[model samples]
Target: MNESTELGEDFKCKLPNVSMSTQSKTMPMIDLKVYIRVVAAVFSISSATALVMALLRLLTPNLFYVEPLDGSNIVLHYFITGLMVVTSAIGLLNSCVVMNRSAAKNTGRNITTWLLLDSLFETTRVVYVFICEVVIKGRGSLQTYEMLISIAQYLLDSFLYCQMILRH
Candidate 1:
C-alpha cells in the first residue's frame, strides 16, 4: 500500500509537467493584452499633451506671434486636436480588443508597427516645426523653445520604443 501511495504522489507531480503545455496557449493572450494597455497609455498621454499645447497656443497669442490665427489656422488647430483625441480613443479600443482576446497576434503586431510609424512621423513633425521656427521665422518666439522640447520628447519616446521592441 505504501509503494502504491508513493507511485501516486510521483504521478501527480508528473501531471503538472503535462499541464505546462496548456499554459502556453493562454500566455500569448495575456502578453498581448499587457502590450496593448501599455501602448494605449502612451497614446493617451501624448494626446493629452497635444491638447494642452493647442489650448496654450489658443489662449496665449503672444507665444507664437509669427502666424496670426486666421480662419485656416484655426481650422488646422481644431483638426489636429481632433486627430489626437481620435487616435487616443482608437488606441484604447484596440487595447480592449486585445484584452478580450478578439485581436489576433498579427493585429497586435500591426498596431505596434503603426505606433512606431506614428512616432517617426511625430519626430518629423517636430523637426519640421523647429526648422520653420528657426529658418523661416527667425527664432524669436517661445515656439522655438517648445519645438526643442518636443524634439527631446520624441527622442525619448523613440528610445523607449526601441527598448520595448528589443525586450519583446
Candidate 2:
C-alpha cells in the first residue's frame, strides 16, 4: 500500500510538469518589432498618399483643387504635401533605425530626436489646419477630409514617437 501511494505521488508530479509545459507552449506571443514595422508601413503609406496628391494636383489641377487655398494658388497645397512626404520619409527611416537590434545608444538617441521633431511639427500643422480651415473659415471647405486624415496621422506618429522614447 505504501509503494502504491508513492507511485500515485510521482504520477501527480509528472502530470503537473506536463501541464505546465503544455501551458507554456500554448501561450500567446507578442513581438514589439512587428509593431515598429507596422508604424513604418503606415508612414510609407502616408508618404505615398501625399505624393499622389501632389502629382494629381500638379498634373490635373482642376480635379484636385483645395478650397482653403483656392485664391492663393495650388503652390501652397504642393508645398504642404511635399512637407508631409519629407517628414513621413524621415519617420520611416527612423523606424528602421529603431528596429535594428545592434544599433548604438547614440543612434537610438538620434531616432528619438527625429521622432520628437516630426511629432512636434505634425502637432503644429494639425493645430494650424484646424484653426485656419475649421475655425476661421468654417467646415464648409472640402479640405476638411484632408485635415481629418492629417490629424489622425499626426496622432499615430505621436504615439510611435512616445513608444520610441519609452523603449530607448
- TM-score for each predicted model, relative to the true structure: 0.46, 0.49
- Positional deviation of residue 80's Cα in model 2 after best superposition, in angstroms: 3.5
RMSD of 1: 11.7
In the predicted model 1, the residue pairs found to clash are none
lDDT of 2 at 155: 74
- The sequence of per-residue lDDT tens digits that candidate 2 reaches over residues 1-168 is 999999898887443335534654775543545655555556555544444544544455444344445644445555654565465456446545544534344345555675675565555456545544544443343445666676777677677667656655
Model 1 residue 58 distance off true place after TM-score fit, in angstroms? 5.8
Tens digits of per-residue lDDT, candidate 1, 54-166, equal: 45655664566566656755565445444544553453454344345534553647666656655644654454454435544423376766666666656665665674564
Model 1 Cα displacement at 104 (Å)? 6.1
Off by over 4 Å in 1: 1-36, 58-61, 66-108, 136-145
**Highest-scoring model, TM-score:** 2
lDDT of 1 at 121: 45
For candidate 2, give the lDDT of residue 68: 43
Q: Give the Cα error of residue 13 in candidate 2, in Å.
A: 38
